[model samples]
Target: MKRKVDNSYGIIPFYIPSEKIVEKSKGCYLYDSEGKQYTDFESGVWCANLGHSNDRIVKAMEAGIRQSIHHGYKFRNHPSEFLSQELVRITGLEKGSSVFLSSGSEAVNLAISMARNITRREKILKIHNSYLSAYGYGQITPGNNHIENVHFNDMQSLDETNFGEIAALVLETGGASIDMVRFPDYAFIQELVELSVANGCLVVADEVTTGMGRMGKWFGFQYYDFLPDIVVTGKALGNGYPVSAVTVSAKISESFGKNPFRHLQSHQNDPMGGVIGLEVIRTIGDENLLNRCLDTGHYFKERLLFLNAKFKQEIREVRGRGLMIALELDNSVNGELVSDLLFERGFVIGYKANTLRFLPPLVIEITEIDKLITNIGEILELLRQ
Candidate 1:
């Protein structure tokens, strides 16, 4: 097919050359230049928790842009102050403080830096399958020995005795977003937290993809009983406005006074981004989106269970919490093929390895959810033949 879109300048060629260019988005649907509407279940890479083009958020963003005098580097901004307080209140970290950044990568990097600084330890431990950005210690390139990777299922391998040498253990609160969304056991996570505490190691909860009511809570860490020393949040924090933050506990904040904690970026603490973030948080509350996500997630899972019962041979498993769900298919069913078929059927979902992932927007309706589930069943039936 002839294509009008240019791929020459694109850094990552994730899609084929003839891919449709999305012209606009509203709520949980995306419209291409050809005026074809696709039910966006991936939620624009899982950041649009409030859905695309939220009216209230758009208005707030416009006013913020118009009124924002400075980016708050040398001078202070009111939006930053308001956002910091909101973050503290929402996260239930009244004693903690936050630092705003531009991306999830930056937030993870800053949180790790703070952990290392406070604990004065060189070694850091993280889950093997967890995705914690690709920058600094989070980066998993070869020859990197400072960070140690431990399998979640195999906790015995993690050295829990190195109290003095280990700085922190970074964890993704819900599931790892790799080939498929693999949520670790709640009991296992709690045990790990207890182990870290016993060993005097700090805990850094990486909530990049799982925060902002994605898991039916303000932050994924809240789902667990324990509170992390450092909480890294991004993705949906500013909805589609490009903002992230690293919030530190009172103890870590106090430790900063003992030594210099240096980290800065050009877009760090920008008032415009702060305003957008605050608005996103407000919209989630005003719209009562958390309970909506919880209820919808339950309904979605039940539908998946019905599909599982009908297509037992093709489907392997269905798992995840809240709106962050996944369906694992047997080796015979190709994930990429399923994704392509869904796209052709006017639905947008994520295909990673052998799993079909769903992160539908919180504003998604029951009718749209029915459409997605019905389409999947039809596609799987056709592929079976």
Candidate 2:
């Protein structure tokens, strides 16, 4: 069989597939062209909270297609309205506003634009590793809006001087922003928020990875004590359908009316994207999967801890929130090697550098997690031997 192209991201043969092709996928499992099945843990880049080929999402999208497929940007569509309104209800931001886009990077880029545009400030602060969509959005306009990196927990670096000239601070709620080596403390995040507010700056939380119950809450910021001036939600918002959204406080949104910050593309708020995303959110609340994520997070964390305790040297630490987990290895085996071994055993996972990220579908059964633990334990033991 022929192939359309490679992923262009890597030499691991990119989207060519180790096998012929992924014939079909469902729930938490995927079948390749050879009838071989593998458990999906990556969630198609950490976005498939509702899992693969969800019927409700699929049907909702089909219904949207049955209606108007595309419409003007200014005129509101039902799906976009439903999504923005539903997100507003969920986040409870007091008339919070939403701007739609089709990707995490785009959503984040627009967010930075909004912050600079509204606050009329010229500096942006980010931690050591930032996944806040501020990346590659041009070089901060050369001191017009300079960037300072605090390296995650260097919150002690959050004094008035360092944050000076800063209009907003952007952060990712999950482990992606700072790498698996270190994550920030919630207290520090709230502190930053309070400080920024007092000093006349906005706070932006990039919840693309940690939102939608992947982290046991609608938004990871909910776990923290305070609110941000702007919040960016993507990834699971469209469940792998390339849709993203930025929600801002009612106060900041007012700036747009005076000088509209035009963002979004032709496909930004596709009817299909909105309807499917809406159904996915509804399914999450309806099934109370949020609660399941919390319970299962505890259970999964306990099991992982047992492994960490068992192999104290190789396992540096087990960290992350809810269904998003990272197994930090201090050993020389390497994360990519471990991931490859697991893939050979019919488990698909990806890693960030040496840190292995495990983001299984929210609907993943506890038994499946156990199986993963068992496989990982046996492999690590063999490697040590």
Candidate 3:
């Protein structure tokens, strides 16, 4: 007799998972237990930028595992040191310092903590529609006293705010969590940063989803004119590995030296995490994936726009940059149903309310994108009836 499988026996029901058991993954594709192949348009929760089980990243991780995964807080690792240097160099945080963590939420919280400690302020500010972190000061809530919200792309909101009491303005440029890939206005961000800085409030860029060439730039903050005081990176940073980083500017690092804010975690600077992160950065640079991401993203958006024009009654709008794209359905159309149909067709995407988000791997080919587009059009035509 064959044994019956119980996939969800002990798993917490935080979110419902798919029934298909993923057996293997490689370069923007997932294979099921039955050997069916599916394109991973969501990039495995927007983490696998270079794609799932990238050979280079896997080799780096294997090497790190052979040497050491963890050294605790007492001893230092060369991987962590080298990774920090690379992060500082890429972010243009001259003489800055970096610390690795296990998740985006932790990195975001650490950045907020640093800003509060450095500014000696009690409040954090964020865009009304932005999603910063899963917990801590970054998580916006109605009852949260320490966090305040300013409307995105609204100058009036900025004009009314008192930056004097704010510690940091946490900015997340693009993500599925915040109504799907909404980019902030250039002028609004510039003024917001200028006003916040003038009032002694630091700017913290939450690049957890928008970093690692997801936005066709090294970091989303680069899209704007100003440089941020602190940067929190995760998701694509380790290319599917659970590693996050908090990088502070030279000024913030200097403040830390004088003020001394102690923060310790078990995996704070694990060699494996450092090794994976460094490999991810190096691979993206060596492959010239940033420019490729730009070109591919433009092509994808154009195709999506063409679809929008074709199905005027189905697609409401197409938005986002780089690999982070969203296709919002019309009010009458059901996005979840559309997503399910696409999943059945061997393509996995993200759906929230009326938005269908696509965060494909940077290594995704134009042919793969065309396949997805064709599937979407066919699905839409079927749903129209």
Candidate 4:
């Protein structure tokens, strides 16, 4: 049967689909049109914090939709209003205001615009390897104009001294890794945040993967012990629903004053999605998932450390926070060989091809971590031989 062509039609299809298919996803599992079940550790590209079909998220969306699919922007909506308030409450950002978007790139664009408007500055500065937004055509159409990408580690240099012309410095706290994790030091990161603020450059944090307890903190900025002028989040906000948000402090949000367009995006403040986001927040708090991430993160972190010592000659580095971990292999190991070995052995681990990534579902069991460590260790040993 021929299927209708839609968005996601081009660019890159990492996994070729022999036939078009759809599936019912629940928890961390996807049951495809072919009726095969696959467990996903990527969590919808790290968006589904509470997993797919979370009871709270689903119920909230369903209830809101049954009442009204959307609340026109003119009339203030409860879900939107409450979710913003709740986020402000949890974030420690004084007088927090939120602008909703359907994707992370839009959130990034909004934050960038907010920075320029507030400071009355023009240039947008970014650090290298930061996933401040997606690389889709939608991003190219808008935020691509004045955006600047620089190396995150290139701070305290001649280039960084040129911030006089920049309005905001947006950073992705998590280091870059195609399939691996590359987190940096708390002190080093804190310096960047502080330096930007001191230099009259508003700091914008892209927490799309670090929010909703993914990184053992409610938000990644908390780990740095500093506040950003604005923070952008999307992936885990709705626990699987299409929702992203821009959170700002009172000082920063005040810049929105007299702006002709507020949330000008047509789909901003869609009620059903907002309700799901509120629920995602509630579930994270009620389940104490932040604590779980810290505990599990530490436990698994040790295993990676142990692996490094065990395979020092073959392991270049191991890094990450909480569930967003990565194992960087030394140049000696054939990354393709290790990736294929793990996949063939029934483990659905992900990789940057050159590095190994472990973004297992937050709900992963203790035994599974053991299994992953053991399987990886065996693979390493085999390679060494």
Q: Cα lDDT of all candidates, in order?
A: 0.83, 0.77, 0.90, 0.74
Tens digits of per-residue lDDT for model 2, 144-250: 33676665566657763456577778766565534752456877777777777787777888788888888888888787777787878888988877888888788
| Local accuracy of candidate 3 as per-residue lDDT tens digits, 101-186 | 99999999999888888889989999888888887777767777998888979999998999999999998877578678889889
**Any idea what lDDT model 3 has?**
0.90
What residue pairs are clashing in model 1?
none
The C-alpha stretches of model 4 lying farther than 4 A from their native spots are: 1-22, 31-37, 135-145, 148-150, 158-160, 176-179, 258-263
Per-residue CA lDDT of model 4 for 1-385, tens digit only, reads 1234344766365554324244687776667676766556567678776877877777777788798767566787888878898888877887889878888878887888777777788777765555655553214335466665555465554245566677888777774343246665676676666767777998888887777788888887787788787888887887767788998998776656655445477778887767888888888888888889888888888988998898889889888788888888988888767876775554556667578777766776677778778988999888877
Question: Which candidate gets the maximum lDDT versus the true structure?
Answer: 3
User: Scored by Cα lDDT, where does model 2 land?
Assistant: 0.77
Off by over 4 Å in 2: 1-20, 138-145
Tell me the tens digit of each residue's lDDT in model 1 across 300-378: 9899999999999999999878899999999988777888888888988887778999998888898998988898899
TM-score to native of every candidate shown: 0.94, 0.90, 0.97, 0.86
In model 2, the worst 10-residue window by lDDT is 136-145
Q: Tell me, by TM-score, which candidate is best.
A: 3
Could you tell me the TM-score of candidate 4?
0.86
